[model samples]
Target: MSKGQPNEVTGRIFDGATLRKILAQVQPYRGRFVATGVLVVLLSGLVWVRPALIRIAVDDAMPTGDADLLLNVFLAVCGMLLFEALLQYRVTYLANWVAQSVSLDLRSKLFQHVAQFQLRYFDKTPVGTLVTRHVSDIDGIANVFSNGILNAIGDLLALLVVIGTMFWVDWKLTLLVLTPIPVLLLATRIFQRVIKKAFVDVRNQVSRMNEFVQEHVTGMHIVQAFGREKQEAKAFAAINASHRDANIRSVWAFSVFFPLVEMLSATSVGVLLWWGMQDVLVERMTLGILLQFILYVFMLYRPIRQLADRFNVLQMGIVNSDRVFKLLAREERIEDTEMARAPEQPIQLRGTIEFENVWFAYTDEEWVLEDVSFRVEPGESVAFVGPTGAGKSTIINLLNRFYVHQKGRILIDGKP
Candidate 1:
């Protein structure tokens, strides 16, 4: 495989360089990101308020036996819910809008850049590989903005508020509820390492499968002509099987991760209840305060468990960004300098062509055409008679500047 080919898989995970490059692309939308962050913070605050409102309604209003206070608290909770819903909606909408805008900018730039690459690039690099980058890779980056970054931040903030409130209500119970955290964190770290590799494997396998299918379909005539259908089918089956295995590994990682998270969450709940009831019995904690703690624990674990999945999204996005940025970083090998501008009026061509001591080769120093000389005057029809690889197409290509000759003086109407 050539350097331009996409068969090589990059093994870098969580690279600072890749992260910075992706951030530079999203710099244009910093204002929207900041606004979304503010909304997330406000939403987190609102989420914290709901549990407190529940506690107040149960402990204060119910003891007073006052229907009016109960009604007011109920209305307050309803208003908060409505406000939170609006903020959530706005945050999601803005995040997705920014995501798609960034994807548009990225895809436009990628397509334009790929279009300018020399023919040799396409000769070595598969069309399906480039298509994957343009579509699949760009979509991955979009999900980073849409479902990864802002949402992860919101979850983290919500988790923090839950923890803070838990400690405020009762630090002892909070500590008890968090005893399973170390084990959960360890499990999450292992899952991250495994899934990161799995995601990279899946991406590489998908690219290979795409390249294989594309090349085979394009060369279907050759396969049929050579009577190699059965052989090709066997080859395709091997590639397809590898792709399936890669996907299965990724699914297996998810299966293990989610169940572990659920178990940890359940353990936290069990610990909170078992220890919390003792405090309630000793008059150290009220029923309402204990109920509030239980609510906070549930809120905390939900986000904590979701954090692992969000991290997977972030990791996958980073990997895709690396590939996309690598493609964009390629420099155009062919320069368009001093191109001839159109004259104010059209000038008729003399239809004369000349080639003097032309030397050319597709690769270095292995000449296909050496010291070739030819001339044809205006209105004269001429043809070069030769075997199959005798520089016939090469002459046309050089005259058209599809491939520039290494050493040549090719002139059309006396202009080189």
Candidate 2:
């Protein structure tokens, strides 16, 4: 098919859906990820084991005056702690390795794809936006690989272990403590919307600010010569103000979001406390179970809090990734046609070219050049002299093939 045929190119402004593909980009390193996740889960599971050992030491060993039980529980707790540390180290090593590797590969692909874009694409797109995507966006994606993706795995592991242990000890109390999660989830979704809007404004404002500063700096001579520093300063101040407002709104969203989530988390703890007291006093549940329950509750809270924080960032990352994916997905307006032939040997020019019966237009309704004809031969001294609308530059542009003519034959050194 020819370059200008139907579906020649497509474009989109956002590409969030492509994050699944991006995440799958790490499939080559799945073994590393699986090892890391398994290690993290084992490490998190060991944390729950400590409380179990503590409950045993207190309720069984100490009460029964069993010296052997006391020694065994103490040793078991130490062993679990050590194993947790070892697993943590191993997981960190694997995660860092995979994250770094995946980020490197992503960066390489972004650079390569950008290099493949048409020169006109870069000409029309802002250098600041391009540089920002090339550097800042890619770096942000790397941060996601390390901080968001890896931490989510760890957080999930910790949550499962804590919740599983809680259910094992007492299912009804676990249910009580978990009652606030739905509320928290709803709040988090609201927070996600706010954060997305705020961050979009923040990023746009920052980009504008960068563009404003770049323009001012690049044109400082013109501004100074025209005595327009005050005007330029006013423009810069406007851009800065918008940037500041967006940033403040982002901070406000996060500030409100995180604390509300914290309060919700605390509410769960409170419910657990109330249920535990009732179980202890009225239901005759033992003190050790309560203590172990409290410990597990705290452990569970850490993971939940972490999970909440990571989810917020992950949401933002996905949004940004979508933007990047959409950009990456765009096809250039013009490309080599299928079955287009490459020149096998360089053509030697005799400084002779011919343009015959040319008709061209920027659009169909307006012809910029009509029936234009020109010839230049070796040692020819013909100079184009005409008024402003005489198609002088258009002649050069058509001769150089910057734009193809609707009806014309341009012969260069012999080949058309």
Candidate 3:
């Protein structure tokens, strides 16, 4: 895709190659990444351990009326909580450090690539678009790691561990508790679709808003001088409204989806309670097991709901990643040859220039400087004046190598 090409939000959210390219940026911090991953795994286990300990306390200590056993479980829970908190802190710090570092490296690389692009590239590409790539888009990518990717992994791990424990206690009750999973998953799918489109619009609107603001501010003098302040202001307001509407759409999707998730969660818990109570009456299930399942349900739905939210972050990051990668992949219109180099020592130009039978045009077959030839010896001063739209400025531009003249040789001190 070209630099200014719009990103399509449908179909696949992330291209495999594009994603790989994005992850490759983290290769420099592999050690930190491994450490973060280990911490996440440990934290996930610790999260599940709390409910397991509670189950043991209720089942073993309470049944036996052993206060010492109860106190030991309580102390162990406290100790585990403290340990989990410490590991969680380390994990968050490492993830954020990697994220900020990646953002820094990515922005620097983007700026360097953009700098190498010829002047014409900038002429066609808006400054606001570039700013979005460097600033907002890169932030989105950082979010993928800090909040979306690794954190989502931890969420999934927690969900799996909770499910596993639920089944270990009672598969029948676990299945009963999970009856709402399909509904929640379907809602998540719908939310993903709605949010994808909303986010795409949000990004586009942001770019447009930036472009409009930048253009107006740079040309504010012209706008006010022509008594077009009201017109420009109206235009700006319209764009601003578009930006706001796009963002609101995303928020609205969230507002709706989260409540649905909560409702489903409540329904699942209600069903679990109704079924578990029947089993308790029959002596087929213990109160400790029932309580453990209730805790597990909270553990389960919390991550499920959070998974949906984190998926949003992941999707936004992918969208921005697509744009940033496209910019990086853009083909430069002008590039110096391998042999191109500056002189070893500082030397003053003799000011001798020649344009031999040069043919030039900004567009096809519409010549601005057709079959043009000129020469000026050292110390000579000459002016070629012409009306507007004539090739006067083109001559100066070609002489300075800001543009390359077609169809002939342009020489300085008789060397091309």
Candidate 4:
């Protein structure tokens, strides 16, 4: 398998709203997602309680050397930590199972559709294109449903927790931390177009590379015979260079977007630190609340970065889904009209054929046969001798139903 291309499917894919609609396939997981969410909620509560625990440790428990209070905090913290760890494990396990299931379903559907597609559809389409859909697109979609959706869930819940902890601990610090979201959103929206295009370019180049390798390997003999190996080498180098450039562009865009997001997150932490210190010295906030706020801030960022990263993968998947869906959506042609089957008691008949008023045309502008006819009865040795481009081979073609007659009926064993 090719090392699937970088994401070339970004800007042109379905919008975020549309992507969510497609993600509705995971609707069956509503119960699981909700359960996980509740776990996360409980987990957040544990996180929120830590500040108070610290306050007790620093301000209350240690103040008068209260050994009993310290022991209680230690036991409570250990219990909450264990539960949180279990929740994390459950969510991760469930998400992975869901990811594998969805990817398998998508690939199976796509394969069924492609299997039924008419010959004409595949005439101009490269096998590489289809392979990309099966391999890359399916994997890309798996990436979306797996890491993308899971991270999104975590991000959303974490955001709620962070906000809640903010208000509960220090709304002033929360306000400072979140003030950059709108600005970041605006910035993301602005660069989104470029980032999407860069990703698409990378995927396209990778696909072309796959196609190139396939063609070259298949035609190795031709290259050797024609003594064009050196020239082909240069051609391949150009393709490799194109692939490299596309990856560079994608990486460049990613570098810009991710760091900017990180910076926005960093700035929020810096602002929170400055604002919280003021409240701290003035006795408006306690040491424990500030510690919880910092942890919440750390928790807040992971999802932000995850969402951004997953968006790119989701975009790539959506792009591939279009092609896969096209394959799945195609209508079959050239099906047998009769429920034909091999007879239980088959009779072997000698080869013979007959055409009655047979007419044929490979295209509209010319008729290889026009209202013409022929008969080849059994035990009669007959030969068709005509100049090239005549309907000689066409009669044979019609007899086999390789090219069905447009007018008049064909009689094979006295059957049309």
- Using lDDT as the measure, the top candidate is 3
Query: Ranking by TM-score, best first?
Result: 3, 1, 2, 4
**How much lDDT does each candidate structure score?**
0.83, 0.72, 0.84, 0.70
- Judge candidate 2 against the unseen true structure and give its global Cα lDDT, from 0 to 1: 0.72
Report how far off residue 245 is in candidate 4 (Å). Answer: 1.8
Model 3 stretches astray by more than 4 angstroms: 1-11, 337-340, 343-351, 363-367
Best TM-score among the predictions, by candidate number: 3
TM-score between candidate 4 and the true structure: 0.79
Q: Against the true structure, what is each candidate's TM-score?
A: 0.90, 0.80, 0.93, 0.79
Model 2 over residues 70-144: C-alpha lDDT tens digits? 999999988877877777778777877887887788778777888767544654556556565666566656556
lDDT of 4 by residue, 1-416 (tens): 22222323444544665476447656766676567556655655555565556667776787689999999988887877787789778867766677777778778877877776654355445666777778886787777766665566666666676678677766667777788889777776656666678777777887787776876786789889999989989998998999899888878877887788889888878887888878889998776667667777777777666666766766676766655665566665445423234567775666557677767776553778888867787889888899999888887766655555678877656665
- Cα displacement (angstroms), candidate 3, residue 51, comes to 1.0
lDDT of 1 by residue, 87-136 (tens): 98999999898889999999999999988777657766877798889988
lDDT of 3 by residue, 1-416 (tens): 11344534454755677678778989999899889998998788766788888988998999999999999999999999899889989998999999999999999998898887766577666677788889989999999878888888999999998898888879988998899899888988999888988999998898887777776787778888899989888988998998899999999999999899889889988998999989888988888888888888888999988888788888888888888888898876564532245668765668688889998876566789888888999988899989997899988887666666668878777777
Task: List the candidate 1 regions with Cα displacement exceeding 4 Å.
Answer: 1-6, 337-357, 363-367, 375-380, 407-416
Higher lDDT: candidate 2 or 3?
3
Whole-model lDDT, model 4: 0.70
Q: Return whichever of 2 and 4 wins on lDDT.
A: 2
Clashing pairs in 1: none
